[model samples]
Target: MNAIEVNVKNGYKVIVDNGIFDKIPEYALTLADYTTVTIVSDSNVAPLYIERLKKGFLRANKRVLTYVIEAGEQSKNLSNYAAILSFLANNDFKRKDLLVALGGGVVGDLTGFVASTYHRGVDFIQVPTTLLAGIDSSVGGKTAVDIKEGKNLVGAFYQPKGVFFDIETLNTLPEKEMINGFGELVKYGILMGGTLWKNLLSDNLSLENCIADSIRYKAEIVEKDEFDNGVRALLNLGHTLAHSVENLSGYTVPHGLAVGYGIRRIAKACKNNGLLQNSEYEQIINVLDKFSLTYIAPFSDNALIRASVKDKKAFADSINIIVINAIGNCSIQKFKLDKLGEFFND
Candidate 1:
């Protein structure tokens, strides 16, 4: 197992490896002395791994409860959030008990939000089953559910007790979900160009190493800017526009795919504005194509801008966006709410 330590509230280790689900109880015991564990999964994942997890925890002499939500980004809403809280309350769960997020980004986000708010706060760990969650949402303590207005508009920065990545889970994912993961992988390659970018270019990377490297880079950034008041926002390299793509699609577009589209859009805008060299722009486009991340939303530039303004990062008059100055390097740029047209206009 490759362990990457993220220094946050108290600090936690992100363990990445194949078939690590059986060892979760040993890891959880180190985080806290909890007696009960509620494994919150999604419809798709519950049948596959819930029993395995429950049996493991039960063997460790811990009370185990399971709650499964409908799968998809659509499930990350206030109604489901309320339902889970009711499940916890009805079971008489205490703050000392634990919550285990046992699915992809949706399960992790919703479960993490519940852990953060229930009883003021409760202990929870992330068992991210999808590539996107394993690389991005499962770390960094950014837990949230979507509101009607926008994605992740209602949530908190509640850190998980620990995160475990079972590479085996990726095998059961649909081809589209696998594609969804590559979207974020491309974002990491662009942000930290080096071995990662080169490996992505050659497609000669091991999945475990790629995941560990991404988590390590994010760990360093989160340690530096835990509250997202500074450098950490760079992690949003393609998210500003990605969120818009998701919103316009009514979230039909998976987030990682939207992010891939976001990165392409930003790179194109930068190239036209002479901020990015043509050679680098082509490199970006090529990598995206290699991953089959060539999705294009039907919306126009003006429509994208309108949708993006509703993002949580948007201010009353301005919003901060990330722009790639070069491959592996990005900087946050402030755009006046209306002046975002610069990203679309030549």
Candidate 2:
């Protein structure tokens, strides 16, 4: 069992272990013994994990309920957010009760937002199923839904009381789902300088260590800048391009794949500006290619450029993007929004 403790507003423990799903009820007791649990899941995951989770809570004699939503990026919007809020309201969930986010990133974010807002705040736990969620979104307090304008436009930095990572579920994951987490996982390698980058290049990097390194990097960032007023932005290394590609593709593409393509684009920009060396840039591409993450956007160069302007990171004059200064370290560069055109298909 690998357990990481995060120090935030509502500090939480992220437990990563094999077959932790069966232990959900066991951990819930450690959070709050006598609270109601509303497990928020999506269509894709509900059929797989819901009954097991429900049974876990029931065994502990805790009153349990579930709220299911369609599984997709589109589902993380105002309509579903409102629906979840209504579910809790109608059920009379108190602030002392618990909201268990029981799926991947989308489910976690939407449920966390609902927990944060409903009754001014309620206790919530994260049980992220996807590799993407397990490595990134599940540990962080960040939660939000997308709008027509952009991704994560409406959300909050609301911490969960606990996060449980059930690695056994990964055995059931589709190939694309594995790539989704790998997309975000690569960012940690870029942000910190050390053996992490070197280890990532080798064929022997275990799945558990990959997730752990990513969480450790993210946990430290969130601790210092929980509100995202500073260093936390470093975590968004390839995200600016990520949002644009997803927007241009109409979100038909998976976020992890889009992030891979976005990271490719950002690497090009870094190489052009001399921030990254020729060999280092090629090595980054090699790693991505090895992971089967080489993707090209179907959108035109101009279209991608235009889509980037709508990102939340874009200010009236500039947008914040992470540039690779070396293999293991990345730095945020604020460039004129119009100059974002520099990153288009090259």
Candidate 3:
């Protein structure tokens, strides 16, 4: 098992391995310092892993409560967040209690939001089930829920107490989910550059090593800019268009797939504007092709522009857009959302 320690205002550890779910209770006690735990999962996930966790906590002599929300992007909303906070309140879950987010990005995000706000922040643990969470969102303290206007517009930078990633859980994910994760991995490779990017171009990509490296690389960056104030904005590489695509699609588009298109869209625009070189642009398309995640957005360019303006990262008339200068190298560019239509017209 490999573990990466994320040093932030509230320091935490991210442990990655194949079968660590069996040790959730043991690790929770060590990281959270709590006797009570609330394991929040989605309906799609609880049926698969909840029983084992419930039993694990029982054998450890700890009180365990379970909350299962409907599974999907739509469930990450204010109503569900309120219900979870109410659940904790009704159960007398105090600051000392811990929250274990036991699913993909949605569960981790919503649970983290609840943990961050309920009584002004409680310790939360992440047991990421999907490749997306394990590789990216699970480790970052960015917690949020979607509003009608935009995705993740309401949230906080609440750090988790610990993150336990069991690659075995990812084995059961649908192929689409796996591809969704690859999109985020592509983002990391683009941002950090080097071995990860090289591996992506080859046929022999190591999933385990790629997962750990991405987490470690991101941990280092997050440590330097935990608040998304400066360098952290680079992480939003494809997410600006991704969030808008998701919102405009009414979220039928999976985040990873949307991100794939987001990356492509941004890359195309950058190339047209002479911001990204032709060779690097070809490489980006090839990487997307290898993953079989290429898909065109069904929404109008105008709608996409409007949705993007609502992005939380937006300031004044411009948003900080992550642009690729080359493969394994990128920069943050402030672009006017009003001019987004020109990119599409190109």
Candidate 4:
């Protein structure tokens, strides 16, 4: 059990590990005093490992409940959030109970939102089944659902009790999904630099191993800044355009894919702004290309620029962008949202 303890602002430790699910009973034993646990997942993931997690919790003598919703970004809405809360209410879940988010980013986001609002707040654990969840969503306490207006419009910064990453689960992930997740891993490298980028460039590394390291990197950041008021925003390296793409695509594009596209565009934008050198930008593009990501946006330049203006990061008239200063460092830049038009022009 390789455990990394993430000390969030509240002084609670979030433990992350590979193959932690097999030791679920032991993990649950550590939190046995909680009144009840509601394990929330999506349709796609439930069929894969829900039973094993349930059995593990049962073995630890924890009373467990399960809620399974449809998979995909479309399901992340007010209705699903309400449904999960209603389930918690019907199940007599208390403030002291636990909510286990046991799937990908969608499940984690929805469950975390439900946990944050249910009885004002409750302890929740993240059992991220997808590569994206393990590397990004699960570690941060950012819980949200999409509204008619935009992605993550209705959300809260609620940290999890812990995040458990089971690498074995990746064996079942589709190749496309793995590629999507790899895009996020690459984002971390682009934003933070360090061993992550090096490992991604290394031919010997496997997706599963890279994911564990990405999660570790995210955990380290969240431990230092839980609220995303400062360094945490660095994690949004490609998210500004990514969210815009998601909103424009009506969510047909997966979050990771949209992020992959956003990263490419951002690299271009950075080069245009003279923040990133041409060679560096090309290297970033090359890595994204290796993953088979569609580095180009599907929409027209004007449409993409318009969608970006609606991003929540837009303050007043300028958009806050987390741009890469180099391979390992990032900085936040505020640009007139309209100024992004140049990047789209041929």
Candidate 5:
């Protein structure tokens, strides 16, 4: 159990670990005496590891329920969210019950949202199956379902009891998904300096090693600031335009890819704003290129700019963007949507 404790605002401890599934019951036992467990996963992951998880929970003499949904961003909607709630309702899940989110960000977000609202909130655990979930979504406790208006429009800040990250599960991930997740790992390197960034660029580092360190890096930040009131916002390094691209792409582009392009665009924005040097921008682009991330989008500059204006991070008059001043450090800057096109044109 390679666990890093995240001290959240509501006094929740989010433990992020690799291969911790073997000790799931033991971890839950330590958290609460919940008699029932609901494992919420997607179609892709359910056929693979749901039984193993269910059996483990059953071994602890607990009643376990499994809820499987279609795997994709499109499934993260009101319909699916309602289904999860209905399942919990039928099962008579109480506050003492445990809600286990077992899949990627989509599963985690949807399940966490249900756990947050169900029975006025229940103790939940994150069994993040993808590299992106392990590194980013699972640790933050920001759960939500997407609305037609925007992404994560309906959600809450519900911290999980723990996060179990199994590196072995990542072997089954599709290459596109892996590359998409690698974009998020790179975003951490761009924001939080230290060995994590170094290991990401190191040729000798393996995916397992990167995943472990990335979880640790995020766990450290979440421990200090669970909410995005301050430093936590730095975690949105590439998310501003990424969300816009996701909306404009009609949910066709994956989150990781959109975030990858958003990172590059933000770097360009920073360079134009005199925050990042030309060499720094080149380095950012080079790393993204090395990861095979798509830095350019299919939309026109005007379309992207228009989409960005509707971003949730955008305030009344200015859009809030997280920009890297240099490698390992980042800050949020407010910019006018009209001038954003200059960054792309520049």
Candidate 6:
């Protein structure tokens, strides 16, 4: 096991390894200082590992409560958010209590949002099951639920007390979920490049090392800009378009898959605009192909542009877009919102 410490205002460690799900209670006890724990999971995950998690807390002499939301991106909404908040309140969960997000990104995001808002703030930890959560959302502290207007438009930057990534749990995931995760891994590969990028191009990518490397890169950025006012937005390399696509599709598109489509569109746009080299553009497309992430968005360029204007990154008349200068190198560019159609049309 490896504990990668994220140094922020309320810093915490990201623990990664096989079978580390068994160690979650121990980490929670050490980090959260809670009397009770609410393990928030989704329908897909509850039947698989909820009992083991419950038993662990019970053995630690702690009270454990479980809440299972219907599994899907649509569940990450104000309705479920309100329901979980009411659940915590009715159960008399207090500030000292802990929340354990025990599924993938949706569970982690919704739970973290609840933990952040319940009583103004409480402690929470992430035990990410899917590869996408383990590498991305589980560690970022960017908690959010979707609103009618946009994905993750309403939320907080509340940090978790700890993050436990158990690779063993990933065995239960469907092939589609694994493909979803590979989308984010491809994003990381493009962002950080070098061996991480090189390793992802191969069939034998190491999950353990890849997770650690991705988290380490994210940790460095989060430490520098925890509130995401600056450089940290680079992490949204393909997310701007991803979120827009998701919102346009009414979130039926899985986040990682939407991200895959978004990355391709942005890469093509960058190449057309003479920002990314043709070789690097082809490399990104090839990588997406290797991972089966080449699904084109059903929406047109104009529709995507309209949806993107409402993204959280939009302000006044311009929006921040992460543009690739090359693989392993990118920058946040402020594009006039009206020109987005032109940019994408290119």
- Please list the residue runs of candidate 5 whose C-alpha ends up more than 4 Å from where it truly belongs after superposition: 11-18, 223-225
Instruction: Give the distance in Å from residue 101's predicted Cα in candidate 2 to where it truly belongs.
Output: 0.5
Candidate 1 TM-score over all chains jointly: 0.94
How far in Å is the alpha carbon of 195 misplaced in model 5? Answer: 1.1
Each candidate's lDDT (Cα)?
0.89, 0.84, 0.88, 0.79, 0.81, 0.89
* Runs of candidate 3 exceeding 4 Å displacement: 298-303, 337-345
Decreasing lDDT order of the candidates: 1, 6, 3, 2, 5, 4
Descending-TM-score candidate ranking: 1, 2, 6, 3, 5, 4
Candidate 1: Cα lDDT at 299: 83
lDDT value for model 2 = 0.84
lDDT of 1 at 178: 88
lDDT of 3 by residue, 261-343 (tens): 98998889889988889988989999988888687888887888788887667787887888888876788887776766886
Clashes of 3: 0
lDDT per residue (tens digit) for residues 190-286 in model 6: 9999888888777897878888889988899999999888999898889888988887887688777899998998999999998999998999999
lDDT per residue as tens, model 5, 76-155 = 99999998898889879887889999999999999999989988899998888888888889887899999887678899
Question: Please, what are the lDDT tens digits per residue for candidate 4 over residues 33-59?
Answer: 885778899888999999998887787
Output the lDDT of residue 81, model 2. Answer: 94
Model 2, position 44, has a per-residue lDDT of 88
**Per-model TM-score on C-alpha atoms:** 0.94, 0.94, 0.92, 0.91, 0.92, 0.93
lDDT of 5: 0.81
Better of 2 and 5 by TM-score: 2
Write one digit per residue (lDDT tens) for candidate 1, span 42-125. 999999989988988888899999999999888999999999999999998998999999999999999999999999999999
Off by over 4 Å in 1: 337-339
